[model samples]
Target: MIIGVALGMMAALLAAVEVTATVRPDVVIGLVIGVPGVLGMLMILMSSRRWVTAVGAMILAIGPGWFGALTAIQVASGV
Candidate 1:
């Protein structure tokens, strides 16, 4: 559960960085998205409990869009 949370957080940060780098080519989106995703998948793969693996997969699937909505809200409110 803890590893899932950490990976989810890392994924969120990577996604945010990817969005930020869209206007600037200096930042590499592939690297940002790939590394954490790979680590998260590895962690999920290593989990012995099926529930843990499911939760991690779900978190990886959902965390990005949820954080993206929050980020959108913040940007809209500022504008």
Candidate 2:
């Protein structure tokens, strides 16, 4: 549970940094950081662990996952 929480916090912090970094320039680098952030968030949610941790991860992932999925959709659609 503690490990899960730590991962969730790390994922959230990574996403925050990615979002801030990508605000205007160096989009590719920002996306690179964000991809792992989103993946880590999903990993936390998908793994069968303590229910409390799972719920915490779910909450932690929502923002980053939403933005990442939205970007993925746009990029794929553009291609």
Candidate 3:
């Protein structure tokens, strides 16, 4: 839980910085997706309830999973 919170906070901070400084839209988007994903993944890890796990998994897929896919595509395409 602590680790998850820390990672989420860090991602938020990074997004804030990107918004204020570079303002690169794509990076900001990825960070936005990642923050909640980290928390959702943490919740999934810590919970035993099936519904909670399912919700977390959905959030995880939409958030960091998509973010990772985008990043990989960008890297592969040299963009």
For each candidate in the order shown, give its overall lDDT on alpha carbons. Answer: 0.56, 0.53, 0.60
Pairs clashing in candidate 1? none
Best by TM-score: 3
- Please give the clash total of every predicted structure, in order: 0, 0, 0
Candidates in order, TM-scores: namely: 0.38, 0.29, 0.44
User: Model 1 residue 72 lDDT?
Assistant: 61
Ranking by TM-score: 3, 1, 2
Best by lDDT: 3
Lowest lDDT 10-mer window, candidate 1? 21-30
Q: How accurate is candidate 1 locally (lDDT)?
A: 0.56
RMSD from true fold, candidate 2: 9.3
- In candidate 3, the residue pairs with backbone N, CA or C atoms under 3 Å apart (3 or more residues apart, or in different chains) clash, namely none
Off by over 4 Å in 3: 1-22, 26-30, 64-79
Q: Write the per-residue lDDT of candidate 1 for residues 3-75, one digit (tens) a residue.
A: 5445556665665557654334223334444554665587698889988677657555444444444456458
RMSD of each: 6.4, 9.3, 9.4
Residue-level lDDT for 65 in candidate 3: 41
